[model samples]
Target: MVKQNFILFMLIGELSKKSGVSRDTIRYYEKMGLLRVSANRRDNNYKEYADNAPDVLKMIAIGKNLGFKLIETKEFLEFWEQNDTDNERLTEMVLKKIEEIDTKIKALTVFKQNLENALIKCEP
Candidate 1:
């Protein structure tokens, strides 16, 4: 079992170092609902971070890299923790992301064609 200190709370700086992600990225993930990061305010109102942040950030980064949005990532993690054996949902999510990628590829092809045309027109 992991120690309590590893999950209770940690300073943002430490979390970043431990998670191999930047503070800004962590903040973005929090905004996107990928992780829950609460602040521990000092007497002067400076903010700290909750522990377990590093692990959460790690999960978020991995999920995002695998094309999971924040919400999808959260659900995936939740289901993953519950020991669910069905992967139909996971497969669907991946397929959906692949569809999105296909759409992006089409859009990029159009843009590239436009750029090529513009370059040809401008050539002396």
Candidate 2:
């Protein structure tokens, strides 16, 4: 069994180091409602973050890497936090994202082919 007392709450600085996300980015996520901080303030008045903050930040990073906008990421995170399982909404979003990626890949391939053709013609 996991120890109940093992939970760790970190300040934003510690979370930034662990998650490889900047403090400014974390604050922006909080502003955008993508992340949450505890209501309880520290002695110095800085907000405390739950141990899961790093995981949430990592999720945001992955979502961004997958081409999700902040609003889309927030929607997905909200759904995930509520359901903890995939649903039609999430599936639809993912399918749409896949289509977008496919379109971009096709365009990039065409661009690459054009560049290669130009380079071949220019060879001396």
Candidate 3:
């Protein structure tokens, strides 16, 4: 039974719809320890997820967009779960990611300049 205003338990289909993540991806996240569902199965034997599952999925998407690997995202989730006052660690990770992106952007810019030079050299 879902609690009122505290926790809303939803099946996989509802989670998939609300989170904008596919059922198969959600299942894979569960297998990778990136997500958790209630151990108590519904009468129909479907897994039930808490309301926060959607929020967690969104966090995963954001991490992926920032170039985090699945393992890194999982570690971030673990830090988030362990303490609310862990912003320092989270900030450090974000800063590191920013440095990596800066390096990639610099390399890509140089590569693009070389390609443009090659194109210019190709007469006609």
Clashes of each: 4, 0, 0
Where does candidate 1 clash, by residue pair?
9-50, 9-51, 10-50, 10-51
Candidate 1 lDDT (Cα, 0 to 1): 0.72
TM-score of every candidate: 0.61, 0.81, 0.83
lDDT of 2 at 64: 90
- Candidate 1 residue 111 Cα shift, in angstroms, is 0.9
Of candidates 3 and 1, the better by TM-score: 3
Q: Please, what's the RMSD in Å of model 3?
A: 2.4
Please say which candidate is ahead in lDDT: 1 or 3: 3
Which stretches of model 3 miss by more than 4 angstroms? 4-6, 82-87
Higher-scoring candidate on TM-score, 2 or 3: 3
Candidate 2 positional error at 119, Å? 1.6
Please provide, for model 3 over 1-124, each residue's C-alpha lDDT reduced to its tens digit, 9 standing for 90 to 100.
3664576799888899988899999999999999999877778888889888998999899889879999989989888777654587788887888899999999999999999999999968
TM-score of model 2 vs. true structure: 0.81
Report the lDDT of model 2 for residue 34.
94
lDDT, candidates in the order shown? 0.72, 0.85, 0.88
